[model samples]
Target: MRADAKKNYDRLLAVAREVFNEQGVEASLRDVARRADVGLGTLYRHFPTREALLEVLLRASFDELTAKAKELETADAVDEALVSWLRETIAVAHSHRGVIGSMTAAIEDPDSALHASCLSMRASGERLLNRAQAKGLARNDIDGADLFALVGALAWLNDQPAHTSRIDHLFGVIASSILTNGVPVSV
Candidate 1:
């Protein structure tokens, strides 16, 4: 792709991601084009369908999370790395609420891009979880699947406008429970 074309494509994807997060999957492509200052044809050229655009945006987010996990793995403190990654994952889930909802609905469809991304995310998460467990910071019994499930539940619960503060409290409780050892308190 030409430099200008690539720039336009990237801008469109960025704008579309924000709009989709704010409005939903039903957000208009025309609006995305307008926001990106690109012609409608340019948007269609890069993303032929709404699903195609959504797939690109969702894949980008998953890729970012995967990269962050890899970086966290190399961090000095294993516990802090794992906690930071989990918190980042929660934030990503919260931001892409509608995308996640759509992905859940499409999980059973073999041809779904959402299904592919979901599998990729699981594999990426497994790598991080395994590393944390090996370091003896995270609980060995709680596998990647458990963490994934927890993230999904937390994401959905946190997406509700009225439950934001409650979700923060819930996350704190979860973190404390997962981090606590059986040792006696010093107090």
Candidate 2:
């Protein structure tokens, strides 16, 4: 964790993020090391496996989202806070092309390197949803698992060239469904 080694680690992480965005979780560690101008051993020294790198790539955003939700939970505009956080979640998932595919599975797998991060993200969203629901703003029946499914659907749309353009609309639709208009929603 010295200056030079830390520098290499950061460089490898940056390169890995870029590479993962372009080529996905299966992107080559060798290529990541090459792009970072570090040796393969250095990359391995920092990240043991592809899953380890993927976990690091997502952990920052998840932590940020969780922090944001904590702040937003106290906001006067509860629905807006939840919707904004939901959209931000979509954007985070969309940032890496194939991350959504892996994230859903990772969230379910207790042993995955990124499971705790995903759980933190989910808990954050649940807090927001509860805040909105408490004020009769959001549907009480829905939960974070519903949002996870929407993330997967939106991420799928994001991956396709044609449907990407409608992502904003999709986000709105989901938000509207979650945020109530005083009518009782069964599910």
Candidate 3:
């Protein structure tokens, strides 16, 4: 891609991200084009469909999260590392609340790229969980699937308009339970 084309693509991605976060996957491509100061053809050239755009956005978020998890592995305290990663994950989910819903819908399509994205995220999260568990900080039985489910539930619950405080409280409860070496608590 040419420099100008790359610039246009970046602009479109930024605009699309904002629009999607505000209005969800159903947000208008035309509005995105307008926001990016580009034509519909240009937007389509960069993202063939709404699903394509969503896949790119979600993959980017997952990649960032995985990188953060890797960095957190070196923290002085294993429990602290795990708690910090969970908090970061919650923040990411809160930032991309609508994108999570769209990604889930896309993943449901048997051959969707979102399925591949999900697999990658699961593997990345598993590595982080395994590392923390190996340190004898996180609960032995707490697997990546458990963390994924916890994050998903928290993300869904946090998406509600009036649940910010509740989400934080829920996250705290989950962090304490999962980070505990003993049996997980019911929160």
Candidate 4:
């Protein structure tokens, strides 16, 4: 890419993050291009579709989360590592509405541009989870996919004022269920 094109791409991704956080996945592409001070055609040239744009915008965060999962693999306590990783992931998912939904959907959609990124992150998480389960620290019933769904659900609940308070309580319940010989947390 040319210098000007690279600058525009970076600016567009930055502006799109702000817009998506403020608005959502359905945020206007024209508004994004306008905010980025680039032509609509430029934006289209960069990101052909809304989902494609989102996938690019979110790829870095996905990579970061996956890296975190890898680091947690060597933590002193497997259970604590899993809990910490889950909390971190859920926090990211709670950054704004529609993020978790997009990730969840993209991970399952084989045709999505984001699918490979999603799979990479999921596989990293699954490695940690499987290791924990092998040590009898985590329950064998759940997998990385299940954890992604749980994170998405928690994030959706976090979006609403009324359900916001339930996040910790729900997380506790989920943690207990995932841990072997764990006690159910009081809601």
Give per-model TM-scores.
Answer: 0.73, 0.88, 0.80, 0.91
Candidate 2's residue-wise lDDT over 1-187, tens digit each?
7999999988898899889888877788899999999999999989997778889888889899899999998899898888788878888888877888778888899988888998899889989998899999998888888877877788778788898787777767767787887432221
Q: What would the C-alpha RMSD of candidate 3 be, to one decimal place?
A: 3.3
| Candidate 1's TM-score | 0.73
Backbone clash count, each prediction separately: 0, 0, 0, 0
Error of 2 at 3 (Å): 4.2
Cα deviation of 156 in candidate 3 (Å)? 2.0
lDDT of 4: 0.83
Which residue runs does candidate 1 get wrong by more than 4 Å?
A: 2-11, 28-45, 105-110, 180-187
Q: For each candidate, C-alpha RMSD in Å? A: 4.1, 3.4, 3.3, 2.0
| lDDT per model vs. reference | 0.75, 0.84, 0.75, 0.83
| lDDT (tens digit, per residue) of candidate 1 on 1-187 | 8999989988998899888877877788899999999899999999988877888887878888888888877887666666677778888878876555666555556677677777667667777777767877667888776777777777877887788878877876665555434332121
Error of 1 at 16 (Å): 1.6
Model 3 clash number:
0
In candidate 2, residue 76 scores what lDDT?
A: 98
